[model samples]
Target: MKKKSNKQVLEMLRNMAEGLGQTFAPFCEVVVHDLSNPKNAIYAIENSLSGREVGQSVTELGLARIQDPEFPAVIANYANTFPDGRKVKSTSIGVKDDSGEYVAALCLNVDLTLFQSFQAAISQFTKIDEKEVHEHIEAGGNHSDRIHARIDDFAAARATTSRSLKPADRKQLVQELKKAGLLEVRRGAEIAAAHMGVSRATVYSDAK
Candidate 1:
């Protein structure tokens, strides 16, 4: 074994993760084993996860093993025919100690389902191909769609923009509104007068 530098070790781990992510493309892959039976597989890697997504359940992930079948046998040894019916591309390597005894099974989950979903969506769009689309839904919109989506996403209603903006943000928003000739109504008597529940004089007095 060669002595690896800290930077080299970190870079190696990063490259491994990146390669795994790419090779496991359209699916998630991870390595975790049962706490009770360290040699048995229990957890799967999920790459399709994002901001608020939680990991799936044993049943949801098809990790539940029947009395006759077990996890390590099901996923770790599965060469083909996953219950989900998708073609699984996976392999499991056992981690061992100095004694050469089985310690844990590293499991990898591939993301074929998400890729299929994206394919369906891209087919719906028809104008664009799946490869050009974002792997994440948040990245939706084609080159042409993005031109207007940018404008639509950034455009905000005055009432909402007014209520949320900070002092500086508010000032900037006001300037933008003024530039567009929308700052004609200040948030004082004029606003109250527009509501028609009170006169401009009462609204002015109420401001004090």
Candidate 2:
């Protein structure tokens, strides 16, 4: 077994940064900093969300790691913000040479703007009146709505749309509907079939 040189280690880290950037693309920025050259430390950058470029100076964290051999090798999930004011979650990992001197740093910055917007949307979408109202509703309409809701729920549980369910999943959904006695309701088969984008005969076959 041979120890890898600092350059070799940094190259490997650069490759890893590229792969990680691609894997979490559109939201994550990966950077590799060569600490030995603090003036132009950024050796590589992928998914450049922060508008920073290669050859940029080392970050404060990277400088800290270079200044202190005893610094933590990994500083993870720290709150950060991009130059454009996007909130970020960041992780920085220090790479040291065999002599235990910091040689490079690999960092990841994940943008949270899209996720924050999605969270806000979900909060508003799920907000409802706390007070309950007792009102007369049509039984036929209620039954039909319930049937369609069940189908939608089933598909959601499987991480798919009702019409995009695989054959086996569709069969299982039909069987569950039959067991729940939903299939016995008037026009239930027709409703389920229509919602699932299948024929009534196909729904009946799946029920069996």
Candidate 3:
């Protein structure tokens, strides 16, 4: 097997960076830095969220890795900020040559501004009034409603409508309802039959 040259390795990393950029597009910036040429280190860039160009100088982190062989090869999920003050989550990877010399760096900077906004929106949307406003919406305690709910839930679990449930599924639903004591409720079989579009006799047969 042949070892890849630094240029070849960098090219492959460039391609990988492009793919990553596309996968996380509109939210991430992917960059490739050629550590061998610190003066013009930016070899390729995708999804330019940071507005950086391909011919830009190496970042401080890149330069540090280039100078220090013992520097960590991967630094992940560090907090960063864009020039425009947008919050960012970043990861940097140092690529080393066969001689164990750092030759390039692959970096990903994910913009968190939109996600932060989404978080804020969700927080506000789910906020409830502190004032006491008693409301009884769920009929979970009602025997009739519970029976109907169980049948509907069983049908949904099988990805079918209650009326479209197969014989085996209907029998399973009846067993589950019996276990829950819902089948013992007065007129429970009638209610289940109505909801499931089946005859009460059929419900009783399945329950047995």
Candidate 4:
């Protein structure tokens, strides 16, 4: 049985990426590469509203995010744009191969020609529904202790000494305190007191 060369494998990978873009696009391009020697790695820039340009490297474009440690894969919200005044969006999802090797990264850049109209029409409804859902969650829960703990966290993250009863501040505090299980879905006043290093009486008093 014959086996494939390095060139053959790269080509196969490229074809797969480009085909995926055409099949599922706002999806303008598919970028693939190994960072070890990224200069030599190939990409399949396919199904482009710009044109079907293929076979390039990140080096060729003067773009160098192949080495960023923190953001190995990111979804660029509004990073891509189109000719004749349409818009595009791109996101890259990185994954290791079956052998646990951090192989190639796949970036899917999609054009938003028809997608934008649907987005515009439904955006108002989406926002309204989300606000209503959040309101419902706020009304149903007996989470006063949990909420105050998070308020403390928000203040700490921002290095704020001043405390106010603002919803935004409360939300931020909740996110920061949430790590200590303060804003947890289930509230236990006794357990919360233990975590806060405070008296249970204080917790009950604050519940009012």
Please name the candidate that would achieve the greatest lDDT relative to the true structure.
2
Per-model RMSD to reference: 15.9, 4.1, 5.3, 13.9
Q: 3 or 4, which is superior by lDDT? A: 3
Give the range of the ten consecutive residues with the poorest summed lDDT in model 1: 50-59
**Shift in Å, residue 64, candidate 1:** 16
TM-score list, all predictions: 0.28, 0.73, 0.74, 0.38
Decoy 4 TM-score against native: 0.38
Model 3 bad stretches (over 4 Å): 1-4, 141-174, 183-208
Q: Supply candidate 3's per-residue lDDT for 69.
A: 85
Worst 10 residues of 4 by lDDT: 1-10
lDDT of 1 by residue, 50-125 (tens): 2112233332223333222334433453534246566545555443333333333345645356667899899888
| lDDT (tens digit, per residue) of candidate 4 on 1-208 | 1123334545666777867866776446666654434555445566556553444444422234444444444445536665566676766655444433334556666767677788987986677442434333433254654555554565566766324434454334334444555434455545444444555565555543
lDDT of 3: 0.88
Runs with alpha carbons beyond 4 Å of true place in candidate 1? 1-19, 34-44, 48-78, 109-208
Candidate lDDT values, in order? 0.40, 0.92, 0.88, 0.52
lDDT of 1: 0.40
Q: Per-residue lDDT tens digits of candidate 3, residues 1-208?
A: 1234878978999999989989999899999999998999999999999988989899899989988989999999999999999999999999998788899999999999999999999999999989877754643347777787788888888899989999998998888888888877777777788889999899889989
lDDT of 1 at 59: 27
Report how far off residue 206 is in candidate 1 (Å).
86
Q: After superposition, how far is residue 7 of candidate 4 from its true place, in Å?
A: 6.4
| Structure candidate 3, residue pairs in collision | none
